[model samples]
Target: MGLRNYLSDVASGVKSLLTGMKVTGRLFLRHHKEKITQQYPDNKDTMVYPERFRGEVVMPHDDNNEHACTGCTACELACPNGTIKIITKFDVTPEGKRKKAIDTFIYHLQLCTMCNLCIEACPTDAIKMAQTFEHSVFDRSQLIKKLNQEGSKIREGVE
Candidate 1:
């Protein structure tokens, strides 16, 4: 019975080795027929990223400079690395009621892990991951960006 078990183990091991070798041989033959590799810089114009690629975070505003951010701090609180900073201000409405508004939405690209947690945590759908991968910069200060545009305000009827 011991000898039989040993032979079975050796047979299974040989079967796994053959399966691995077959896959390797298939890939080795495919390498000569297919040109899957792409050259950078030269092919930058035609380069395409995958669907789920995560890049820098950006806040999009409409033509009227209105955004959806309500200054709720949900995105700021959800960020694991503290990449998002929300500076809120109290704006007095025409009805004499003070409302919370976003003053400045600062994003530190250097500290960001691109985990998409902040985007997912936003209740108002305020922020999204922009499909921009070019982040090379000579100065470190350039990496820190303000997500909100100047003179931008929250859209009307948004909670």
Candidate 2:
């Protein structure tokens, strides 16, 4: 009885495999006019990605090199892995009070899962997902990016 049951299971598995292959063969033989495949390299210049595509996280700096990130570490805490590192420094205000500021915003793209959790946790809308998807690089170090621009300061009115 055990041998018979094993044979029956193997037959059912083969049947399922054949059914999946049938569908794939039918699609493979479909007319060329169908939009089943995308010519990626050919249409590289004209490719249009959807607006909701979460490619990478980025901090948009304004014309005056000001960002909205307050070194709150909200994004770093929200990441499932240690993909984001926010190095902070204390800046003395005019009144001699210390305020937290971001010295560097390190983003490890190789470790990122593109979960969008960090973007959602940002209270000041300091970071958001960018649309640039081509992230291939020769060296692994190239995947590590510093989000904040040089000499960038916190934007006025954004804490």
Candidate 3:
């Protein structure tokens, strides 16, 4: 009886192995139609990302080089990783009234986890996540980017 049981166990193992091999053989034969390998760099131009894909943060500046950031620091506060820094400047109106404005908006790409919390916290809709994912750089200083365009000022209605 023991001998019969051992023989049955061996037969069962062999049957399972053969079944797995049969599936693998079928896949090997159908590899041409169902390509398992991607061409990588060659397919870069054709690669498409979803609408909701989060890559990096970018501030959209208008043709006038103006943006909606009011130096409110809402983005700085909401960032979980302290990736955003806002340098403020005082804008003096014609009436000699001083108002707070954004001097520079610094974004540390190396520290950012792309959580989108900063974009959500912004009341002025200033910042948004860009679809550009290729952010690799040789130097760490290159990763720290200014989201605002050069010589860009806050929009007129942003106050």
Best by TM-score: 3
Q: What lDDT does model 1 reach?
A: 0.92
How far residue 99's Cα lies from its native spot in candidate 2, in Å, is 1.6
Residue 1 local lDDT, model 2:
61
Q: Candidates' TM-scores? A: 0.77, 0.78, 0.90
Residues 56-130 of candidate 1 have per-residue lDDT tens digits of 999989999999999999998999999999899998898999999989999999999899999899988888988
Local distance difference test, each candidate: 0.92, 0.94, 0.93
Q: Give the TM-score of candidate 3.
A: 0.90
Candidate 3, after superposition: displacement of residue 127 in Å?
0.4
Residue lDDT tens for model 3, 18-42: 9999999999999889986789889
Top model by lDDT, which number? 2
- Once fitted onto the true fold, the runs of candidate 2 whose alpha carbons sit more than 4 angstroms away are 1-32
Q: Model 1: residues >4 Å from true position, as ranges?
A: 1-33
lDDT of residue 61 for candidate 2: 93
Pairs of colliding residues, candidate 1: none
Could you tell which candidate, 1 or 3, scores higher by lDDT? Answer: 3
